[model samples]
Structures are given as structure tokens and as C-alpha cells.
Target: MQRGGRVDGATLANLAGRDGGSGWGLKAVRDVHQGHRLITLPSGCHLTYGANDDPRLLALIDKVPSELWGAKLALQLIAQRLQGGESQFASYIAELPKGFPGIPMFFPRTALDMIDYPPCSQQVKKRCKWLYEFSTDVLAKLPGSPEDPFGGVAVDINALGWALAAVSSRAFRTRGPTHPAAMLPLIDMANHTFSPNAEVLPLEGGGGAVGLFARRAIAEGEPLLLSYGKLSNDFLFMDYGFIVEDNPYDTVQLRFDVNLLQAGALVSNVSDALGAPLDLAPRTWQLQLLAELGLVGPAANPELNIGGGGPGAEVLDGRLLAAARVMVARAESEVAGRGVERLCAVDRPLGRDNELAALRTVGGVLAFALSNFVTTLEQDKALLVGQAVAVPQPGGAGERQLQPPASEDEMLAVRFRLEKKKILSRALQRVGALSQAAAGNAELKQTAGSAAAKKGSKPSPATSKGFGSKKP
Candidate 1:
């Protein structure tokens, strides 16, 4: 490699091997201070390009088969490659010997050419088409490098990893201080949370010393929790479909008594408020984020709307989720004078006796309900997205036919799980607002039409009193 001109003492600290000479066992890393940010990547890579000029990197690619590729999977695979892999992936990194004459490390373009498939495979061909599409102009200008497959250089490990996964993937940068090539080793050891520990202090010079700070006061045997990312309740739900029971990240965070459920609800609300729910389609998301954003209606408050819908919806990344949650918490603060109740009316229903009981119940299960509600909210919102499988209302009108028609055969499709009956099915979303319909359909006020209005009749003055349009 180039005469060791990396961070101070990084090379002296460890050989350019994956082990980094410290074989520190994975106990999970947590940040000790709040507002601590460890800069992971300074920038992204050019598609199919790497810093390496080594002919050996390219030589290795000649040995790899370029035939194996799946086009539909190719997009996801490329995204995965960009994000990199888990910390444990260092094992694979360590396997590559340093000072090798050819293929010093995993190469970028080499990895693309290494697809192990037959020449005629449609997937492989599709990926090739994707590369061409990218190279041409689909996503801005792409570079064209038709170098000899045999003598191309090894792709940078980070670039290859990024190709494997996008920078946004949760597993992208989860690795601890395994190699200097990664974020300053010990710095990564401090995990990330939406609310992070103070791991960074301003230094006299330019760069700050990245340290692992404590999120809370430590007692012996407590598993320190470093924030992973600004994971939203909706994103989390989309990811795991419920509160993280088996998640290695959050479960370990719980040792510090971090309440994920409470955080999740706040995430859901703020994401909703920001007019960014799950953007299923790229078109819909572009409209929301890049075009008209926020819940308030357009220009003169003319068109009413809800945020975040469609198939292939874009989820709120961790950074935005974390900040939005803070906004939600502050907005709901009674002292802040906004007068927004933290819970929906149905969640804490009215009535003297019921209210008292509800208070006790809320007090008793605040933590439990927080997680449960966020989980339910996520599932419900996913339904509203309704892009993947959209069918216009089927069956006779008002005859109780399923919306977005589903066949008996479709419902009958069997998925054999070990505990088939134990896992609960996700609840469907209410057509407009799952929140109003959370308890039941009865609570939803039909501002547009009720049974009387549907029958060509006008509603009584009392019934139509306070209904207002929702601006988006």
C-alpha cells in the first residue's frame, strides 16, 4: 500500500489486517455521551470506480465468473453492497492476506464482474443493462470504464462493501473497531442511537478525538448501549414487523434501560407530521419530499392530504427519525403550551370511572403500550401505502366486499411457519386514518358522508357542527 499515510498512529496501531491485532470480543458498543457523532464515511464512491490502480486487483476479476447475476435482485444487491456488511464481516476481510501480488483486497468493478451465473441468465443481463443505464444518464452522469477485465485493479474494500449495501442500510456500518480502514476503530465500537452519547469533544486542531461515551451512569455488568442510528418506529416496523425481540442492537440497548417503545411512538407521530410516511413509490416520495412537504395544505390550504404512501415507499432514515422524535416530544410537552395530548382520545377514553381506570392502566403499562402502539401504528401505515398490490374496490357497493380485492386463493396461500398460529397477523389500515379507527370504526366521524347523507339526505346541524377539512 502507499507508505502508511493514514490517521495518526493507525498503521502503528495494527497491521492492515482485519483483526487489527486486538481481537476484542464483540460485547456490543455504546456511546457514553449524548450528541456524540462519529463520522463514518467522508463521502460516497463513484459507481464502478475505486482508488486502487493496482493491476493485481483487476487480475483477480479475470478468474471470477461474470455470468452469475439476477437483475431484480441486482438493484437490491447493489444497494446492499454499497452499505457494506456487519462488523463480523471483518472475518472475511481478515482472510485476505496483505502484500499479495494480485488482488490485494476486494475490488469494486471486480466484484460486479464476479457475478456467478450463466451467460444467458436474464438476471445477469439485466444487471449489465443497469450498469449501462447508470453509465448513460438515468442518475446523473456516470463514468464509462471499459478497461481490460484481466488487468484492472482491486477495488477498495470500503467501495466494494458499499456496493454490497447502500450507505443507508442498517447493517452498512455496524462493524466495530476491527480495521483502520473502517471509521476510527474504537469510535465505531460506540454504537449510535437517535439519542447518542457524547463521544466527541472539540479539539484545538481540526478533527475531534472520537471516543465511546456512556449513555447513562454505569453499574457493573450492564450492557452499554451505543445508539445505532435514527431508526424510526415505522422503519423499524417495516424492518422487523414488531418491537425488536431478537434484535442484537436494541436488546442490548435495553440493558441501559432505554425505552424503545416510547421512542417508537414519537418517531411515528413526527414522521407523520413531517408529511413523510413510507413513500412506497419513488414518484410519490419525490412529490412529498422534493415538491410539496408538510401536513398543511398547498398554497391557500385548498387540497387536503395525508403524507407518505404508495408502493416502494421511501422510509424516513435514522437521522431524520431521531430529530423528528425530538420535535414530537417537545411539541407534546404541556409546558410548551401546544396542548397536544400524547395519547389519542380513544387510548385514554373519557368518563370519570373509565378515566380513572385508564390513568391506572396507563401508569401500569406506559412502557408496554408505548411499544405496542408504535408497532400497531407501523403495520397500519404500511397498509395505507397500498402501492404494491392495489385493486379498485371490488364486489357490489356497500355490500361489504373487500377493498383492493383479494381472491380466496390469495388468502389461502399458505406460509408454513414453525409456530404458525402463534404469530399474530398485522392489522389492516383504516381507509383514511388508522388513528381514528384504532379502537374501532365507530369512533371515526364521517365528515363527508354518514348513512343519512349517503341516502341523499342532509345531516342535522348538531352532527355537522365542528367537522373541518385536514390540510396536507
Candidate 2:
């Protein structure tokens, strides 16, 4: 390469129709063995956030909110792009994508609305709004002024969006979390996969050169792939403009509300002995337990998750499950003095009734959440596969023919929601099994009690109600 970068067994090629049609990727020119270094670029070649030395540009970057670091880097990239041949990294800048069609920030209003998940929708709107305001309120007035960062050249929202997308989709944090990210030229071209074939590592002795090594033996003509992170679809879609099929790291967010829990308890057929409404109000001991688990009180984190974040993670958050179990408990003796860890463990059942109520309550909550989606899981699947399906119209008016996704954004949105539904559905199945087991245990206990009464002998204290405490 012209800029002191080395490519040994790999060559850049147009990899259209592969890896979500990212347009370009690095392919193996020859067989590469495990641990072989594939590519290397010196530190000087990295396009970092703090590399730009212009005082005006630095001042503007300072004014930009720290949370909007992407915008700061976008400013630097735009400045370099405007410089053309005069810029030191002009060739690298020229090779960047002219436009980012895949990014949601560039999606039209109709396409944007297709992203049904509120968490991701809110983020996309916030970034788009910031880009619009910054372009109109600040960057537009920079031309012909002493504080001009782009040398009298105008920077518009479109250009700003392009730079922001480029940075978000390509940049990597080579240094560490606290430092600004850097855009590695050829290294960034490798497409992402959950199971990566190659990995990036710094050269030995801190020489400032970064190297990419093969994680396993590679055949000739294999495209190099890298793992971005254990990110959920919410992040993968928003930051990288693509979604993974059945990503193991995906999660569905829910707020831990007592009202929702109460509704779930009611749906699960749980009732009070006193014939009172199922308020699900936490008792003092239960409140203390929830607070200790960090699910309620001053330091509580009410955000709950339905799916796991990575391999071997619980389908439901431990703290959330523990809180639900504690909330449904009828008496202090049912869960008194039990540590949070034991309550959080799925294998540790407090009692047959308590376990059934907890599992059924969780199932009810999942069902309620699923009901909020605009389309059914079956309809989503049919639409994703380009099948023409008839869906019921609102208010029982009539059925309407649902068409396939019209654009990539719509397809991704459908895919996002579909995965979330899958997670919820899987979790529901699990809870159903647990609930059945708990019911079976309860029936066995009841049969034993009936037999004990028939014998006219008192039931063993150990087997009687409120008998013993779980070992801490």
C-alpha cells in the first residue's frame, strides 16, 4: 500500500451480495494458517478524533457535547475531505463511501417509522435531530468567518450525516474505552460476524503498528471477518446499519413496574386469601429484599431484560426474576431471611405455590408485551419472506393484504421486532414448563396430605405448612 500499510495474504475486492452487501471486504489470496499476521498499519495511518490540530476546529469540538463524540470526529473528517489533495490522508478520505444508504439516520420518515422498537427509535430520532440543529445553527454560519473550520467551504446536514455514518460504522477503539476511537483504513473493510475468523491485536513491544491475525486456518478466497462486540440488535442496527439473524446477544427491555406485576398475577389466576384485589404491594421484608437486590428503592435499576446478552446468560435477568418472586410472596415466613442470591437462582424454589405463581406471572408479562406489537409473529415471518398475507384491519373493519418490506430499513425493522418476539416466545415456553413442574409438585404434596388425613395420624411437622426455612 502507498501509506506504509502491509497486506500479506489478503487483497481488497468487491464482495457484493455477501455479508449484508457491505460492498467491499478483504479476501484471502492464499491459504493462511492460524496465528498468521494478515494485515498491519502503523499508528501514523490511523484517523483518530484528536489528531486534527486546527485551533478553530478544536474549539468547535469542545463546544460539541461529550456524548456526541461521533459529531466531533465527523467535523475532523469533513475538514480533511474539504482539503482535497492538501490533506495528508487525502487518499484514505477519498476511499470512504460517498453515501450511507444503510444507516437509519438517512432513512425516510416512512422507513423510519417501520422501526417499531421504542428504545432504538428514540436513539435514531435524537441523533437525527442533533445533526439537523448543529448543521443549521452552528456549521452554516462558519463560512467566511475567522472561526471557520472548513476553510470557507459550506458544510450541510447531508455531508455531516455522511461523515457521522462513516465514523459510526467503521471506527474502532484501538487505544481503550477512555480514549477516542480511530478508523483503521483496510482493517475496517472486514465485514462483521458473531463468529470471527480473524482478530486485531497490537504489534508486540508497543511499536504503534496494529496487526490482524488469523484465528484459525483459512482457505484461499475466504473473506476475513471480525466480531464487533457482543452487541444487541438495538446497537447493531442503529450503529452499524445491519442486523444479525437470531443473534444470541439480543435482548428485550422492560421496566420493572408493580402495576405490570399485579396485572400478571391476576392473569395467572393468583388471588388473595382475604378476597382482596391482587395489589402486589411489597411487604416490608419483601421491600428490603428487593432493595438489596437493586431492583427497588433509592439505588434501584428498574430496567429489566427478557433475553440473554451472551452465551450461558439467563433468559430472564436474575434480579428481575428475584424481585418478581419476592413481590408475589404472601408471608414473611415464605421468603424471610433468604439471601438475594438464592432467590435469584432458578433452581432454588421457595415453595410449589410460590414458584408456580412467579413463573406464571412472568409468562403473563411476556404475553402482555407481545400483544403490543403491530403485527403477529406469523405475519412478520410471512412478510419477511416476501409472502403476501392477509392481516386483520383495525376495529374489525376488514382484512388487508400485507406486502413485503419495501426497503432495507423496513426489512431491518421487521427483522428486529421478529427477533424480539422470538425471544419472548422462547421465554414463555420455558416459564410454562417451570409452571407445570411446580403444579405437579403441588399435586403430589396434596395427595400426600390427603393420605395422611385418612390414616388419622398428624402430618409430619416437616411436611406441614410453613414448616422449615431454606438454608442460606
**Candidate 2 wrong stretches, greater than 4 Å:** 18-22, 274-277, 388-401, 442-472
Cα lDDT tens digits, model 2, 330-404, are 666666688878888875677776676677677777776776666778889998999877867879899988788
Per-candidate Cα lDDT values, in order, are 0.25, 0.75
Q: For candidate 1, what is the total of clashing residue pairs?
A: 47
**Model 2 steric clash pairs:** none
Candidate 1: list runs displaced more than 4 Å: 1-166, 169-184, 189-205, 215-223, 233-472
Residue 165, candidate 2: how far off, in angstroms? 0.6
Estimate the TM-score for candidate 1: 0.29
What TM-score, computed on C-alpha atoms, does each candidate reach?
0.29, 0.88
Which candidate's lDDT is highest? Answer: 2
